[model samples]
Target: MKFLEELQSLKEQIKRRVQFDVPEGTKNIVIGGMGGSGIVGKIFQEMYTKMPVYTSDSYDIPDFVGDGTLFIAISYSGNTEETISSLSYAKKKGAKTIGISSGGIIEKEADVFVNVPGGLQPRSAIGYMLMPLLLSFNVVSEKDVDYAYSLLKRIDENNIKDEDIAKKIWETRRIPVIYGIPGYRSVAYRWKTQFNENAKVIAYSNFFPELNHNDTMALRDTYRKNEFFFISISGGKDSRSEKRIDITKEITKTEMEEVVAEGSSQFEKMIGLVHRGDYVTYHLAKLRGVDPTDISSIEELKRRLSKE
Candidate 1:
């Protein structure tokens, strides 16, 4: 299926899927996965700040994880070694565990199981993975899901414009360095990964305030400007972050291009920016004459690792 068609199907899947309840007395939440499966937790961690939410991409679970922790193991294929290892460790530590996948060992072992649809690329199934996870914690309402669906539908309608702009920005040889304010860091990171996986290009991401302290200084060297294409993603309400973004733009005026996200709510901005970036990566793939859906290197790495 086409990427846009897969995205369009996401909300309908969410609407039909069953919801799980967060266990009572849960104090902390830890999500374990990698690649597309892992990024969902980072997005949630940014949105839900009242309690501690950690995303573990490594094999080892944090020392603080215990019975009070609600550990979520997410792997679309149900066989990601790192997430499975972390989930096993979490279970041994007596943490309440929920597993999200189509079918795998996690489905059998987890205290609660969330079954997402199989077949689509894990990255393309973000809505399927994210909405159910958020709904379980009551972080998002059904109305919010409906609103997001509407927004995505609108984005689909205007995707040609987004694609035209993306085609213009295609730089087959230059590395893409994406930057965002703290609030839009995850979105920027998503864009970076899309370029990496979809366009088969090297990309990197960093956030503001922190980047201003260190990375901003590197932009002074005009020698490297032609080698990199900088893209700054801005969608923050914080005055300090906003100011830093503005100043950083001035500092890198000759080196970087800017893209601002638009939306009234945090969810809208996050998903909206992601929707646009997805198209950009798609167009970038077209410009480079590469198949956007192919990830041969990753598959090769997985095959090699499986032998060990």
Candidate 2:
């Protein structure tokens, strides 16, 4: 399937195939997975800020994870070694465990299982992997999910103009440095990873106020000016962040791009920014003449790891 088709699959993927409930008396949540699957956890942690949510991309469960912790293991392929290993540790630790996967030992071992649709690349199945988990937490309403689908449908229908500019910047072979505020930091990370996996290009990401203290210092190095393209994902919620972006632009004056999000609510802003970035990454992939869906380098690394 084409990358866009996989992204569009979210229209049908929101229907949950397996159902699970968080146990009562759970005090905290810990999510474990790796790579594309792992990103779902990170996004969730950012979106559901009311609770103590931690994401682990490593092989072992964190020391803080225990019986009171609700551990969610997410692996679209159902066989990510790090996630499986973490799930095993969670079970041994007596944490309440839920597994989200297509199918694998995780499904068999989890106290409860969520079956996401198979066939699409894990990253491309963001809605499938993320929506169900968010629903479980009650952080995302059905209306929110519906709105996201409708928003994507509109974007698909209305040609994205940002694609042309993004293609031009990407074709220059300059490294992409994505920045955003607290509300849109995850979106920036998503853009960076999308470029990494889809465009097969190296990209970096950081949040505002924090980046101002250290990363802004790099602007003094004029030799690196032409080597980087600065892209900011602005949620447009904070005056401080807006000022920071303005200052950064004034300081560097490099080839900069801003993906300003429009929405009345934080959730809407986040999904909107993510939707835009996804399309930009697709265009970047097209300009590079690479299959956006293919991540052979990651597969090769996994193969090497399996042999070790």
Encode model 1's per-residue lDDT on 101-203: one tens digit a residue: 9898889888999998888888888877787676766776666666767777787777776676566567336788888777688888988999999988888
Q: State every prediction's TM-score relative to the real structure.
A: 0.93, 0.94
Model 2 TM: 0.94
For residues 1-308, could you state the per-residue lDDT of candidate 2 as single tens digits? 87788866655565443356879988899999887888888888888877799999999878888888999999999899999999999999889999888888888988988888788898877767887777777776667656766766777776466587567666788888898888678788988998899888888999887987888777656877788888888878578888888877888664468778876566667777777777778888888898998888889999999999
* Off by more than 4 A, model 2: 14-19
Off by over 4 Å in 1: 11-17, 236-240
RMSD of 2: 1.8
Residue 290 lDDT (model 1):
88
Backbone clash pairs for candidate 2 read: none
Output the lDDT of residue 222, model 2: 84
lDDT of 1 at 49: 77
